[model samples]
Target: MRAALYFTPSRDSDLTLAAAEWLGRDPFTGESVVSDVSGSDGLVDAPRRYGFHGTLKAPFALADGKSLEQLEQAAAEFAASRCRFTVPELALGRLGSFFALVPARPCDALNAFAGDVVRHFEPFRAPLSDKDLERRRKSRLSPRQDALLCEWGYPYVFEEFRFHMTLTGSVPAEQFDDVEELLKTSFAAFTGKPLPIDALAVFVETEPGAAFQVQSRHLLVSAETEE
Candidate 1:
């Protein structure tokens, strides 16, 4: 099994429902949703398997001497030690050939938070398999990214990380504008608002090719009270 740290809204939140509907899968309920957007099922085919989430730590199997219980405990401790905050705004944007919701401006706090997660749980992460490494290298990464991949098992971490809730897979250049507009319309209710980074979720993929599902959510405790 592989585990990932992700950012997802509370199970009952309106944002969760809306994003689930848009993506055609609800990680919370493990139910399939019929999307209203034309050709949305095809567009979201890749991301749907992972559900609606922004990756904090990319998925990896547990390392030798690691157990699921230990991972959960570590995640809870990590969450409790952190402070909650919100991103000022989010907007629909295209990243290369994919569409996603991205922060409208840079957030130092968010970057630090994500970087911390990547580092904290790394000890429990198993080394990437040769096949996985090869697949990542196929993307034609820069020297720095290749080095990060060798160290972190993922290319995008630390300075290279860009927080995005992927909404589609690789899209044809010709279809980009139409897809972007469709997503904008579909997600109008949730975009351009303060997005809370109040919780961290642990997602698990039980086996290869299985859809990832939320195993637990850990709330970020307020720093003021801790002090």
Candidate 2:
């Protein structure tokens, strides 16, 4: 099994519900959702497989004798030690060949938090297999990214990471505008609003090429909550 640390809205939040309908699958319940957007199912096939989330720590195999239970416990404890914060706002924008919800501006807290997650869980990550390394290399990674991959098992960590909640797979150039318009309409309610970063979600993929599902969500503890 492969596990990923990700940040997703609360299961019943408006943003989560809207994203579920747009992506055609609810990561929380692992159920199919009916979408109003034309061709949405095909458009979101890629992100739908992984579920909608901002990647915190990329999926990794549990190292050696480590088990899922241990990872969950560690995540819970880590979350409890951290304070909640909010992204000032998010905007729908093009990220390479796809569209996603990205922060409107730089967020130092979010970056630091993501970096901490990557380093904190490094112990649980198994070294990348040759096949994994080959696949990552196909991206023609820069020297710095290749170095990060060798050390961290995922190239996009720390400074290389760009937080995004994917909305579609690669859209053809001709269809980009139409797809972007559709996504904008679908996500209008939540876009441009401060998004709470209060929890860490653990997602699990039972086997290779299978759809990932949420295993659990650990809420961040605040002063009031701790009290």
Candidate 3:
């Protein structure tokens, strides 16, 4: 099994509901959600398998002697140490041929928070296996990305990390406009709004090809509540 640290909104939040519907699966419950997007099940299958989330820590096997229970406890402590913050606005944007909700503008606080999550979980991550390394290399990574992959088990981290909640895998050039319009219409309620970064979720993949499911969620203490 492998576990990842990810940012997914509260189970009941509007964004979460919309994402579950659009992705056709809910990570929190491991249930299929119905949506009206044309060919949604097929169009989003790639991301649907992982559920709706932005990667904070890519999936990794636990380091020797580290247990899920231990990781959960450490995550809880980490969450407690953080104060809830927000991304001023999230806009629908294309990353290459894929579409995702991305921050409209960079936010230093969010970047710092993601960096901290990666570092804090480093000790719990087992070194990537040779097979894993080979697979990562197939992407033809740049020198810096290759170095980061060797050190962090993921090529994207710290400065290279770009937070994105993937909406679909690569869209066909001819269908891109239609799909983009469909996504915008479907997520119109929550896109381009301040997004709360209030919780961290532990998502687990039981086997190599299985879908990831939320194992637990830890909420950051709100400043008002902390006071």
Clashing pairs in 3: none
Worst 10 residues of 1 by lDDT: 34-43
**Root-mean-square deviation of every model:** 1.2, 1.0, 1.0
- Against the true structure, candidate 2 has what lDDT? 0.93
Give the per-residue lDDT of model 3 (tens digit) for 1-227: 99999999989988889999899899999998877777565678889989899999999999999999999999999999999999999999999899999999998888999999999999999999999999999989999999999999999998899999999998888888899899989889877799999998999999988999999999999999999
Model 3: weakest 10-residue lDDT segment is: 34-43
lDDT string for model 1 (172-223, tens) is 8888888888888888987898888989999999999899999999999876
Give the count of colliding residue pairs in each prediction.
0, 0, 0
Count: clashes, candidate 2: 0
The best-first sequence of candidates by TM-score reads 2, 3, 1
Off by over 4 Å in 1: none
Scored against the true structure, residue 214 in model 1 reaches a CA lDDT of 92
The stretch of ten residues in a row with the least summed lDDT in candidate 2 is 34-43
